[model samples]
Target: MSGDAPISTPWRPSKKDARYTGPRACVKCHAEESATQHLTAMGRALEPVATSEILRAHPRLTFRSGPYAHEIVRRGDQSLYTVTDGVNTISEPILYTFGQGKAGQTYIFRHDGSFYESRLSFYKDIQGLDVTIGYPREIPPSLEVAAGRRISMDEARNCFSCHGTGAAYGNQLQLDRLVPGVTCEACHGPGAEHVAAMEAKQFKDKRIFNPGKMSADDLSQEFCGSCHRSAEQVISNKLLRGLITVRFQPYRMFTSRAHDPADMRLTCTACHNPHENPSADEAFYDPKCFACHRSFASLKSPAVAKTEEKEGRTDKACPVAQSLCVSCHMPKVEFPGSHFKFTDHRIRIAKAGEQFPN
Candidate 1:
């Protein structure tokens, strides 16, 4: 499960060879999975400004920091992002809304033929706007800077490649041919070949990449980590030393002492159903913990003993408690200034007043 051979997938959006057939093509066979997955956060990750429910619900949202003022207002079918310094002002029609607004939504717009990420983002907890995460906190020198942070060509390509399907092609972002949100083709690779194979009953070689076939370690560190930030990505990017890194689940989980690379049960997909939103019910995860932590004697079954013997390892049940194990060990930590709390993936006894592990 740890050092298995790499499983290749043709899901790279940057390459023109990947032909995406959209999620609609998948509904003919996988009706249920297609239906539920489309309702997940990843399904609605990116949407056009005109169809944003958050903006439609709240016609106007505003925030002020230092001498700058930011506002996002809905007029007709368009949402306008405006920023001002009293003397000078800049405004633009938001082109896209990133995120489904479960936690928050950020806007992206074009000004002077350049892409810019909105300076202010809508936080659901606050029910208004605030400075977008990772932006400078100080006052901007000009109205253009106050309006939004201009993104580079590479940044734009990267953002769209992850948020939307078929948005990237050969080192560039092809926004004109973009498909909003992470559709079925996004993870499963191009479905045109798979669909045709299935239609013709050619089961031998379906020609679709199944990420489920990947090993536990490869799935966590390579497949999902390609977007979610693997340990290698965090370390290389010099982001290994902050509360902000808590948002990167793969990196935090990789750093955990409890992380056994050979255990498939410890992988992300083992606990989280990637096709749906993560379950908030703590009880849902107890079985995942019990798969390893239950005492062999307590099991009173031969099957349990056989499994533990085969795995070459056994873990004792928690001496302290049995239920809601994550409440203490995997506590949720609030990201500074983001107005959101993310569950820390580092599985350990979280002692109060203790410094965050390096």
Candidate 2:
């Protein structure tokens, strides 16, 4: 498989991806910020790979994704990332280093079919050692493309607007129209309107459709619920598999104890870096009950640790439930991505229906 050196033309919508917009449009307004994004993990996932210099540096690189189904290949310096065809519903390959493996390089291949931007491969071992992949909150591959809800007017269909940067939705049956992922306009909307206003000095239109505004409440809060909440599939389509609509579902994060319409109000940007992933590696989000929270002297989920012990070490300052504010409040529970492991987003007392110690 080969990836292109650089896409020369702008993404054109296939009938299947008529509702989508590409990322390039957003960069027109956010050019400066996206530069640093190319370095972070979130940006790295979507980083374009098309050079022989990076391709030939490693002995072996990943060409597929996932642990069981992942594949690896060695590249020659003469080779560059290029697509086999320009118009087919197929993808090219690029090397990515998820982490190191005992034997050598462990990686995943980046791919696109045209209508949407998503990763493939089952992600097995990096180098030769087993590695962690996919954040606790990310959707899986089998269901990512599975057909359930129709793409024309479903929330699931609309989700790709932000999930993908420059992707477009073409004809209902045409997956090839969903091209590219994670472009700037996905969040900021097409600069065609914004840029035009800016050039005309229409300062009032600065936030024509910003998420953080639009109501007395922070409109951005709705952004997190777009993916965090769990809702039923309108149909059985896998491509529409992510949480797109924000209607309340019991299992969804919004209904949990951590979220109270009266007490707690959090937007997507409140606890997360929107330009990034689910923020799993943020030092507190291991599927485990303890990580950074093991130090909270107070019972706040994200509370820092402070010790008042007779004789103990500083580590004790962050006691297990005592240190973990989330543990104390947002009890850990299991979900699809983590069956054996539990999640802590609800952020309330660990013992359900029990009185909180704090």
Best by lDDT: 1
User: Could you tally the backbone clashes for each prediction?
Assistant: 0, 63
For candidate 2, the per-residue lDDT at 176 reads 42
Q: lDDT of all predictions, in order shown?
A: 0.79, 0.35
List model 1 lDDT by residue over 111-222, tens digit each: 9999998877788888888777777878877788778778888788778777877777777678987888988877887778888889999999989878888888888988
Tens digits of per-residue lDDT, candidate 2, 1-358, equal 1111111112222333234434454566677766555444334332223332233444443332332232233444332222212232233354333211211222233333222222322222222322232333233344333111122223323433323344343312222433334444444444465666776889985733465543312233333333233323222224432322112222334445334343223333455555654454433533233322233534453323344222222222234433334445544433232112334444443565653221
Error of 2 at 157 (Å): 8.2
How much is 30 displaced in model 1, in angstroms?
0.4
List CA RMSD, all candidates.
4.2, 11.9
Stretches of candidate 2 exceeding 4 Å from the true structure:
1-35, 38-71, 76-163, 170-180, 214-222, 227-252, 262-264, 276-324, 327-343, 351-358
